[model samples]
Target: MALNEQLNKFQKQQVKCQSTLSDIASSRTSVGPSRSSVPAAISQRPVATAPVRFSNDTVRLTEINNIRKSPVGSQMKRVIQLLFETRQAFTPEQINEACYVDMRANKAVFDSMRNNSKAYFDGRRFSYKATHDVKDKMQLLSLIKKYPDGIAVSDLKDAYPNVLEDLQALKASKAIWLLYSQEDIAYPNDLKCDMKIEDDFKALFRNKDVPTDMLEVEKELLKIGLKPASNTAERRAAEQMLGVPSKSKQKKKKKQEISKRTKLTNAHLPELFQNLNPSGSQN
Candidate 1:
């Protein structure tokens, strides 16, 4: 029994020593001074290189010609802007198609803008213009300057809320082309689509509880020569004062009107004379 017990203790010690030696061997293998313990070798790292990607193999022009272009030139300033505004320059037809709506609906405004925009300047190209088919921000600002009371930032945004970039550009460029915005206002209860620009603007202004900033705008507009409407009640006053009164339309042609009057007058007179006169006179 003693011999068996001694043998069992020796076996346990052997197992423990084997475990400790195995740990030491692992540590030595990881960080070794002797090359023979673990053979030294160098393997390729096989690094990941991004696949070569190539695109649009063209050089771009950064500068522009200083000499202004003719108004009718194919590459005039705004047209050039329209070209570079997006990924590609738009075709002439694209520009035309955008502005060629029923412009007669706002003939007074469209004509004024079209005629005035021609003399205005473009910020980037530093060129003068004679015509602007599109209702752009700068052009709109010029009109607002002429009629300061008639516009606002909200008015401009409502006019073209979809054109965020244009509004942002106006801000970034520090172009003062508009009346300062009053606080957004509630719509009038009795809203009408055909309200005159002045009336509509004032209605919105009043409904906003009369924002304090509006006082400055009102003063600025007055300074710039925008007149308050002589009378909001006088819809026809402008036409009347200008002697351009619109005539009421008549459905019948002048010849048809004359014929109808002649028939009526002749019908009564002929019956009376036929009863009193001879056959030859009647015929």
Candidate 2:
């Protein structure tokens, strides 16, 4: 009787295990395939996204609205600030792009600003005009002559924004001279004293066989009691006047020559063979 009861208990436990497995299997089938059972490539596929698009007119209108929301004083101040930061002339369209200011809407403010001494408008573009006590061409010339050594073009431009026009006029009239190097330099023509070159020295220079090397030429000039331009600025100016090419150009020419000598084509073969048999006694 005891063995039969023990066998009945074992059968009941086995039946419970089978029902639990069936429930698990049914749940998996209802939920579809397990994540682990799916291929990794299909499971990790990327989803496509649509791009956001905007029209130019829409963007410009949005910018203009934002500008309109700002205070009147702030808008004007922003335009002025943009001009000062760039230190360059800008058209109405350019200003609008940079500062989002609607030139058409703020025409009255711009007109007043242009009429004022602070801003300069040349029919199309606007720029900041710095007040450096240089009002006219005479004053500009006086300022340039004040610096005996030479004044930098950048400083002059900073002092007077319309300096280039005046400089061109003055240069045409022989009132001033310009030397362009790493930094452009302006000199008053009246201050320059012309050097007197003797006929004998001129003849010497014409007749002398000077070396192509600048250093050697300098030494040769020194030996003849004549001074070559010692200052770098003077040397560059002299080279420019003589139409002499710079060292970099000279180096490029030398490299071209070397390449030509080294590069042999079919046309060069006959000449090379003839040189190899200079006596024409080859079998």
Candidate 3:
């Protein structure tokens, strides 16, 4: 009986050892994290994504395309404001940048501005032409400011050309007419006369052949706060070289010639009549 009891006790001890080993392994097998573990496993979540909105032009893609709120109305008003601000002439890329397109507008916005525009074109770049008549001349003038009297057509795009048409028009109309004459002075004939202000402003009382007294005339006009007819130092210099018109001088010369002719005719009259004796006798 003692031997059997001891065997049973030994078997029970073996069973307890096995149970401890199993418990230790089971504790390890439990999903609970250990002190040595880097971290516990956590439920995974999908990454948040922005809404995709692809448009026709890949070059114009922007982050704001996925905006949840509708800014269409306010954005449109601002775009319109910018459009009116474009009263000044501009190039295409210049206009696009001014509209703050990417930040405020999209491809649709630019399309809307261009939708009704018949005068604008994109070539070489973009240009908003005025009427073709004015457009070409304005362009030519713009070039002429950089290039003086003459420039070549082939070189104009990069090397400006002379625009004679505009100039000839200005010259013919005498919009830049030189003051050529001093006529009968009516209201307040004084150079400093307030009455002459209107004529001065209208450029009607130009000193057509300015006298040797041109400086004196200008000084007197200045004394009365009246600006001289000239617009520039060069113009004043031009007017300075100006003299009384040949037309008026010609009239004076003709009058003198007529007076001399009248005197000579009177003096020769008696002699000529006497020399007509043969004709008179025949009569």
Candidate 4:
């Protein structure tokens, strides 16, 4: 087929698919058997795939421009391409390294992209909004539900790298949250097993009765940012707070009290001791 003919045919197919998708969406939302039944039949039909019209360079530049209108469009094009291709979350530093741009110097530009609705940033990671889909969003929500003790954001990134954007969207919409966020306490009961003492150790106390293990002792030390070995003084203080006693010290103190009582009783009975001594009686 001629190039122009192919383009026209592709455009027509694109329009048809758009109409079909709209019909499906509307039909699902509209109440009544007639509209609902139409969606089922339409859904069963094979849908036409959209043609790839844009070359790599065009697609990259177009996405960059859509995300930000500035001289850094070319630089940001590399950023956008990295995100779309990897489908993984990245920090600004990682993005800068991948895209070969100084994100530190262009912090304002990257920050703007982060704050924009087209991009998703959870303060530490970034992703393109287009990489996300509804199914992924739902799956992430289900995952959140599975771990009542909240799952780590890092774990989420590892499991659903491509859906980082969707996770952020869910967070923004209050569908999920970073576990134990004080500001948004809706997921307060979703316990997070973090190494940080305040979040993990104190959380144990908050969620359970008094801990009875040495691990709990370690957790209390961790919660207060103290090392058990190096911070012996602090560890002792924490142990005291948690009612963990030093068994050896207690035993030693008990022995010392018994010895002191014997010495005192002997001092009070000095006259009796003299009476029992033959040498004293002769003097």
Candidate 5:
């Protein structure tokens, strides 16, 4: 009986050892190495990822097909291309129709492109940068010519919000005229009398030419704020201003020549009379 019990005890001990070995193996597979066992360099290393980037030409091309294909990227390219090609200020609905993309769904795409592509394109609420400049140059001069009373700056801003830069450029070149309001005048001396008479003098000044006749020149001078005949006795002032020689000066020069001719004729008279009558007879 004792021998049989010892054999059973030994078998149970062997089973316990096998179970302990199995548990150790399972634990090792389930939990990996402890944190302390890991090397300091391996534990502290940062996770790496691929860099995100877009091509510079992505913003420049005016056709969707020109850009690499992607859902958001293709839509953005289409929107940009449409804006560039039409050269028109568009409403959100118009943009939707034109690009065939939903502004709501692609808000992120548009926003991203707008932020990224400002140097290449400036897209505003109702206007685009490139077209605004062209239109302003084409229309501003003609518009100024049409409205001699002066067009309101507010009206211009509303029509072309992006046009301030264009205006500044034209103004700097003196190609466009500015009309100051009474409120804008800091002092009475600051008021420009000539510009008041003509809202834009650049156009008028360009149209006028120096007339040949002093009288006609006088008439044109009157139209441009030069005082009429009686303002003062500044002789030939208009001619001098026009860079022309005065008619009076010309007349005086001609008279001097005629007087010289008369004096020469008188001097020769005695010789001719002597030749006709050698007896010095009076005829």
Candidate 6:
């Protein structure tokens, strides 16, 4: 009985050791491999990811949100007001810093102002163009008189909003003269020096049957005791009209002729060889 009890105790101890070993094996399996077992290349390799791209609208919205966090009212109005108050030009970045707004948000305002012709942009800077003080015909006339060479009508239009009506009134009263060229210009009229052209002269100019030929025109001028233009400029213009080449063109032709005469060719080689052959024969 003592021997059988000792044998049973030994068998129970062995079974317990086996169960502990099995539990350890199962735990190891559940935990996965150790860090040391992973390959070095895979462990060190960088993971690939897709790059992030934002659309124009998303970027614009983000910029607006970022800028709108400030206490400023309208970004555009603030920029314009700043420019007007300072009466100076500013770049988008400068304007942003001055108004404490983002440049991206202000750019849209600048573009809108430019498109609407409410502001002036000289490639890099923006300025309020309608800051002129002229408000009526008298002021407009005074402004015109200040510039003897004349002022551009477009500039006047910018200076005074209702400048067109005032300009017509001034012209009717002979207070100013409008000269049309590539651009319309306003010149202050001096009635003392202004000569009235006869209606007959205007009629002659407007007549379709009036001679278009230069010689016929010259004859009419001669009949009226008026001499045709005899200045160097007039002569050159006449020469151009007659299809005569200019002095520069004539010089170019002369240079070409001289070059052709001086140029040596294979055709001259035979003569040169003949001259040399006579000397060779004498030798």
On TM-score, the leading prediction is: 2
lDDT pick, better of 3 and 6? 6
**Taking the tens digit of each residue's C-alpha lDDT, what string does model 2 give over 1-283?**
2322433454464466667667766765664667678788975775333333333344445455567567766777887878766778988778877877656557666676677575789999998776555767999999888877888887777565577899889888888888899999998887347677787886766667758667777787889999888655577899999999776977875543422334356552243333332333333
Cα-based lDDT for every prediction: 0.40, 0.69, 0.42, 0.58, 0.52, 0.65
Better of 5 and 6 by lDDT: 6
TM-score of predicted structure 3: 0.19
Residue 88 shift from truth in candidate 5, angstroms: 1.6
Please list the Cα RMSD from the true structure of every candidate, rounded to 1 decimal place.
31.3, 26.5, 29.0, 24.9, 24.6, 27.9
Off by over 4 Å in 6: 1-132, 194-283
Question: Per-residue lDDT tens digits of candidate 3, residues 1-283?
Answer: 3323443455565566667667766765673454345333432333233333333443322222222123644444454454334434444445445543332235554454454342343532333322222335455445444433333332322211233454445335433222223431111112233343464544543434344455777776788999999544566566658952333667865544432123345552243233332332342
TM-score for each of the candidates: 0.16, 0.30, 0.19, 0.24, 0.22, 0.30
**lDDT digits (tens) for residues 114-216 of candidate 1:** 4443333232122223132225776654544454234334544433324446655654554433233355321112224446667667566545643334445
Tell me the tens digit of each residue's lDDT in model 5 across 147-245.
555555555553354566766666666655665775211111122443544536646664566575566767777899996664322546765787986
- Residue-level lDDT tens digits of model 6 in 1-283: 3322443454565566667667766775664666367688875665343333333344444454455464434666676677666768988777755754554554555566566445678888887667456767787889889888988888877564467989989999988889999999989887788788787886666555767456778888889999888445577788999999775867865543422234346552343323332322342
Write out the backbone clash pairs for model 3. 155-159, 179-208, 180-208, 180-209, 181-208, 209-243, 209-244
Off by over 4 Å in 3: 1-99, 103-105, 123-125, 133-172, 175-283
Candidate 5 matches the true fold with a TM-score of: 0.22
Ranking 1 against 6 by TM-score, winner: 6
**Runs with alpha carbons beyond 4 Å of true place in candidate 1:** 1-134, 177-283
- Model 1 lowest lDDT segment of ten: 58-67
Residue runs of model 2 more than 4 Å from their true location after superposition: 1-61, 68-78, 81-131, 158-161, 191-283
lDDT tens string, model 4, 131-188? Answer: 2233476776876776665665654554445566877687787666654453322232
Q: Which sequence of candidate numbers ranks them by lDDT, best first?
A: 2, 6, 4, 5, 3, 1
Winner of 4 and 6 under lDDT:
6
Candidate 2 structure lDDT: 0.69
Q: Which portions of model 4 miss their true places by more than 4 Å? A: 1-70, 135-283
